[model samples]
Target: MRTLALPAPRRSRGRSAVFLAAAALLAGLAVAPAAHAGDGRKAEAATLHDLAEDHGRYFGSATDNPELTDTPYTELLGEEFGTITPGNSMKWDATEPQRGVFDFTKGDEVVDFARAHRQRVRGHTLLWHSQLPGWLTSGTWSADELRAILKNHVQTVVKHYKGKVFAWDVANEIMNEDGTYRENLFYKTLGPGYIADALRWAHQADPKAKLYLNDYNVEWIGPKSDAYYELIKQLKADGVPVHGFGLQGHLALQYGFPGNLQENLQRFADLRVDTALTEVDIRMVLPSDEAKLAEQADWYARVTEACLAVKRCVGITVWDYTDRYSWIPAFFEGEGAALPWDENLKAKPAYFAIRDALGVRPKKT
Candidate 1:
């Protein structure tokens, strides 16, 4: 692959003052050339796979993170992978940080980038327990107020981004680890109907976008998995506009990857909704153990292969493109290097492995 010039990072506002500094630093780093000579556009065009971007603080472009540039994103685009999942760009807190007051600046920028590149946008998480503002959980508002607030929030954000976004993780991580329904403020206040209502409202707001129910750990076919299966079945039976399922394949090299991921994904596809391998990344402990690195590569290949084999599995999205910007280290102490690319923007063995799995020859440009 030939080398390409990196674009200067742009600035974006965050909910907190601390993120402003972090975003600035990211912007600066984004423009520096991360690729070697003769490896810019030519090499990237050769080896690039059409995969989706995992949106988060690290994956945010140079503008959003001063240290990084839009070159990587453009490289990915050149590779023919045009879909992106806003890691957290459209989350409840980010979009509606202060209740009725909605913010679409960051999310819009991402959408605009996707549009400029002719890429598809996945609107992540219309509903989730984490990253929610404190005001919603204080239990201070009446039920009617809460319902009005929730309805307004969904309608406003969805309508604002209508047509630009192709799909949405309408509800995320609603089930608990123990296979029971998690008690989120919306559920506690609005009851089970809220799930259906949220979906209904989202469908009404943007009828074109595909709405999905996203969750982690459903890769396995055990009790927790059973709970999700039944929940979706019920939702479908109730005639909800739920169109897809997002399986977050956050794998670890130490523990074995889920035994029957293909079969599990197939079962969901049998329900007639598309499935996606969302937020995929295999983590390894630091110090760069070769054995673990090899294992991680193998895991990436297998997951990519599985997605390809599953006809309904639209695409696979890595949580981050490179290790330098991975959320694993900060979120999971001592864990690092959780992506197909290394921090220096070099392809790891996993990159080739994924290409092999996708049955695409590396470009010789």
Candidate 2:
């Protein structure tokens, strides 16, 4: 039921990033940074991930198993990002499709790829309400039965990838937009204590791994974030193992950029918890024009700036690096072009914008 995903692997669209660049130029925009003769080799090769490291942060992207077949896509993904998340590979349905049985093949492929590429892996989720196995969702269970099932799943998954992953979104999207606990299977069966329990389980499974509570639409200051503020505060007071708050930066052009995003992240940092833009993507209406693309670039810059502005804002991860594998078209009608690179695997204005935000520049010849 994670409706936001419809990941079609390697369905590349469009032609000629040169055409994209020409259009951008005609619209009076500086295109993404490209290799130049006079540029130093190190600067020329430095990627977004490298630039982010200069700021002491990591730049990452989410990837799936199938997209690994795409040579060009995988090449850029591995080169430009320092971290990767298995978009759906690590979810409950994919990991443990049967009661008392676990499968880590899909998730392991991603981890292996990241390891080969020398990139760190972030375990996407140990528990979620959507994309659940039929048996678990269909079968009925009492509170105690459900609690044991939940605990086993969380700890087993966390331990399986124990030393490989540096972080785990122990629970995901467990809050309603209106700032109420989502009455998901766990919440309804085991009560809100499930979050604390899950976090503790993950911590026990891998003490070094960072544990996070992830949700979308909490980027800006609002009732939804207010709810998380109160929740995290109480969790800290109660000595829960909550370590980070993930703001899934899934934004739409029509909604306008989130207000006071830096201040919002700052407040969370003030709570002595780490913060990250877990899933960054900015989608726009279909038939995207130069203006829309430019606007998207501006938003990317702003988000990067906001994260850089905060000391504890650890890192940023695009939902994926390129629109070739983007989920926007499948999930949001008449909305696409949600990533820094277009479907052609060529960087766009947004890519350069992000680089500029990270303080990278092409030295003049």
Candidate 3:
């Protein structure tokens, strides 16, 4: 949160041809501006299960094309999952891998799908240290070049999506595990001030969109979490237009989840901004580990209950809808099945636990 002036750009080695091709396709698409239906009781009538509810701001998920039409995500979720993040559809590398080039075809598909279904969208991220084009990390551009690139990238994407997206994770995973700032390509090239600039630029692109700074492991009170807390306070004081904080609640049973999560959420609410339990999933070893499964269910219930208890905690989004699509196993190596539903689209025990925690009564067949 400390205001650091923008630093000099590192360098850029250039981008890949494949990345550039995809980016071009995104830029060429004819995206019509989204129409705001306004907030009203009629909009609220579409219960969280109706995809058209547009209120209560409950659960959301990162969806793909196949799932958009064929899976239970569209059917079972209905209006309940109002907000949609592009699982991996709108990353920096995907949107604009090369210089000055922008591609939003995949992301646009998501937007189109959401619009067709009458669901709201949350832009997954605008800036992040991960999943960036190799050229960005190559460190070839001057500070000026990088700044222009960053600004243009943000402006273009925001302009394209504008009213279609309700909120955005403007800057992601900027803090280190110790709660100190992590020096990624942006930080290394542009310095600490880049965070504020990113937020400001994103706001310029779409003033209506609620911008948020997102990170994982901030659900508990610790050095890292505290660092983010202080950072938000400082940004708020600076009048940065930062409207919310996204707690990437990716938990593991072995790590021993936060003991005082409800208190932690209240602290953020006290700051008078919205909060969301983004990318939530409690993972354990597979092959039906009943004891660990039970523990996972308990943890899921706790997270859901905590979010519900906090007034400003608007929504909770699982990383993936089903274990089959979960990124945990690939990322965590040995971690498996980390979602409310299994690959077969059957509800896991954790699913029922979360539903009950949310005060949602199961429908009798």
Clashes of 1: 34
The clash count of every prediction, one per candidate, is 34, 1, 19
- Better by TM-score, candidate 3 or 1: 3
Rank ordering of all candidates by TM-score, starting from the highest = 2, 3, 1
**CA deviation > 4 Å runs, candidate 3:** 1-55, 65-74, 77-80, 360-365
Cα deviation at 262, candidate 2, in Å, is 0.2
Task: Provide the lDDT at 345 for model 3.
Answer: 67
RMSD of each: 11.7, 6.4, 13.6
Residue by residue across 1-365, what tens digits does model 1's lDDT show?
Answer: 00011112222222232233223423442233223222334433333332222111111111132222657545643344456667767888788878678888878877777677666778887888888877666658778998898889888988998988888888888877777887988888778788889999999999999998888777767666678788888889989998888888777665567757889888888888888877888887776655566566667777775666667887776776778677778776787788876787766666655654554332344
Off by over 4 Å in 1: 1-47, 50-80, 360-365
Better of 1 and 2 by TM-score: 2
Error at 205, model 1, angstroms = 0.8
Candidate 2 accuracy as lDDT: 0.84
Q: Write down the lDDT of every candidate, Cα atoms only.
A: 0.68, 0.84, 0.72
Using lDDT as the measure, what is the rank order of every candidate, best first?
2, 3, 1
Q: Which digits, one per residue and each the tens of the lDDT, describe model 2 over residues 141-191?
A: 999999899889998998899899999998899988778999998899899
